[model samples]
Target: MKKAIIVGSAISVIGLMLVSCSSTPEATTTTTRQTTVTAAPPPPAQTTTTTTHMSGSGY
Candidate 1:
């Protein structure tokens, strides 16, 4: 009968869908390790100054 044929087709289609959906395994992402670098300290700060004199004051 047409009804039986339709039912059989529907069942077959559902089985095929489930098989296709679960046929392949999921892929996982790989992580790369990270590296850290440390830098050396900077040199100390320095400053110099000079004094000025006027033409003839006892100073």
Candidate 2:
């Protein structure tokens, strides 16, 4: 039983080491982009003026 336990533990450790060493690390990069948006100003509101003449004005 003791020999079996030791061999099993050794196998588990070697398996973990092999898996960790065989994997490759990946490099990651992030970039930020700036964008400008331009919009035309709206036109001013129009106003109309009307003049009325009254014929009779008495108090």
Quantify all predictions' global Cα lDDT against the true fold.
0.88, 0.88
Task: Please provide TM-scores, in order, for all candidate models, with all chains considered together.
Answer: 0.45, 0.41
Kindly give the stretch of ten consecutive residues in candidate 2 with the minimal lDDT sum: 23-32
State the lDDT of candidate 2 residue by residue for 1-59, as single tens digits: 99999999999999999999888566669667889988888888888889899888785
The local lDDT score (0 to 100) that residue 1 gets in candidate 2 is 100
Per-residue lDDT tens digits of candidate 1, residues 1-59? 99999999999999999999998878869878899877878777766677786677766
CA RMSD of all predictions: 11.9, 11.8
- lDDT at 41, model 1: 81
Angstrom error of the Cα, residue 18, model 2: value is 0.1
Q: C-alpha displacement of 55 in model 2, angstroms?
A: 55
Instruction: Write down the lDDT that model 1 would get.
Output: 0.88
